[model samples]
Target chain A: MTTEMTHTTASEPVTDRPIMTPAVDVYENQDELLIVADLPGVTSDSLSIDLEDDRLTIYGRRKALCSEDTPVLMGGGRAFDFRRVFTVPEAVDAEKITASLEAGVLQLHLPRHERTKPRRISIRTAG
Target chain B: MWMTWNDFDRHFAAIDTLRRELERSVGGTRQSRRLGRWPEATLVDEGERFVFAVDVPGLTQDDLTIDVHNSTLTVAARRVVNPPEGYATHRSERTGFEWKKSFTLPAKIDGERTAANLEEGVLTISLSKLPEAQPRRISIA
Candidate 1:
């Protein structure tokens, strides 16, 4: 599995807004894998998630509350978009995958395919 | 001894499992260069009122405490991490901490009329300037 760099050089950097990698935590269990990401100021309309070809990508855009054109009394926080990518080794149940956004936090649940889950075999006693 | 197709596949699977474990343990954590400036804040002057905004994602209104005194506004919050049940953490990059920050206003503020709102993980506080501080046109005869 590999992590993708948010600030890629392939594309020219947007002068007013740059790209940022949102912080995330990955959790796994026998039933499913849980991915939690923090995307501040991201709205439902601006957030996007995609999974294809064993790659999972999370992208979001946040509108700046204070624009650069306006007069500034103090400046600290800069405006930026968020993006992150991850690779999945095992086949996931795409139909069962669920995602939700609350308080700007994104939570994704990827259930393992039934075929990929471990199963116990029963043995019969010899007569 | 000769290798069979099944054996070859099993060997590769074991090696793949080992590689996956190593990657999980690597567990990257970025932002060393931008340390000490978390939940960045900005203050902007909009005519008669000033707007102060902060980026505190994944935070609820109850998780924060705000105090305003004259031209100084203080925002404090203590974040707690609570992992869900029946889950094993493979990588944890999100951190929790007690953070407090203050911003200064350019003009005297009418504290009584100041208002703060939290939406989509951003906290925006509007401080209206006092009547004395508002710009007034002066005429000379």
Candidate 2:
């Protein structure tokens, strides 16, 4: 069985303000890695993805839509910022990283480097 | 062997079950926040309305149901996982679940005025308070 290692090392970097770490699911295949994070209430205009020092960072803010006339009586509202960081493997093709957000979920695609792809070996019969 | 997403989900579910057992033993009768399959929810009394927000990632309006009966609000939904055919899943952490919850309104509300909307997987419900239940300022004689 081929063992696939998910996130080897994940950390929540300190933001200027405290932030919640969005729940994430990671998958990998022969060609690329997929990272999906659930960031409800976050809009595309407020989402940000960055890569620095081999660490992939995701940040987003979900704006609250309350008005002065509306007073919050109960707790547990989901209006806050999201932040998470993951260390990328050396085999990843950082230059080819791509991301998309839909319905409040963010998907990141990281392609494998050409050299890291597996290749089949051919045997030569004795001449 | 190629690992499919279904296999990965089973593995995680096993670990989650074990973890829950440990927590139950150590925490001493603490209740989990999960309501059915949905995450924790918040209920707010917005003076004129009661607002409900439930975290339901990867869900759409078609998957949810909202109803009011006898001053109680009920929300129900199911999250289904369907991976594309032919793609071998290396890992998976998201799984399908059923979410069902009901809450008793603190005060009478106008059921006819209730409204709900789903955005980014968060289901929000607004229950307008009955006119009599609203606070009224008394004028000094």
Query: In candidate 2, how many Å is residue B3 off?
Result: 62
Q: For model 2, what TM-score is found for chain B? A: 0.69
- Tens-digit lDDT track for model 1 on B11-123? 45644543343333233334522221255566677778888877666888889998889876778977776788889999777777576755555557898999998887778
Q: What digit string (tens of lDDT, one per residue) describes model 1 on residues A1-127? A: 1133423323555575767777788998878899998887899899988888787888898886766677654544456778777887656888788999988788999999999886778999999
Task: List the global CA lDDT of all models.
Answer: 0.72, 0.68
Task: Looking at model 2, give its docking quality level.
Answer: acceptable
lDDT of 2 at B105: 64
Q: Per-residue alpha-carbon lDDT of model 2 for A1-127, expressed as tens digits?
A: 0111123224343644436656566877778888887777787889889899788889888766465446443443535677777889988999999998876678899999999987888999999
True contacts kept of each: 0.70, 0.47
Top of the candidates by lDDT: 1
lDDT tens readout by residue for model 2, B1-141? 344798667645644543453334223221221111235466666777788777677788888899987567888888776654434565454556675656666567788999998887778888888898675677779
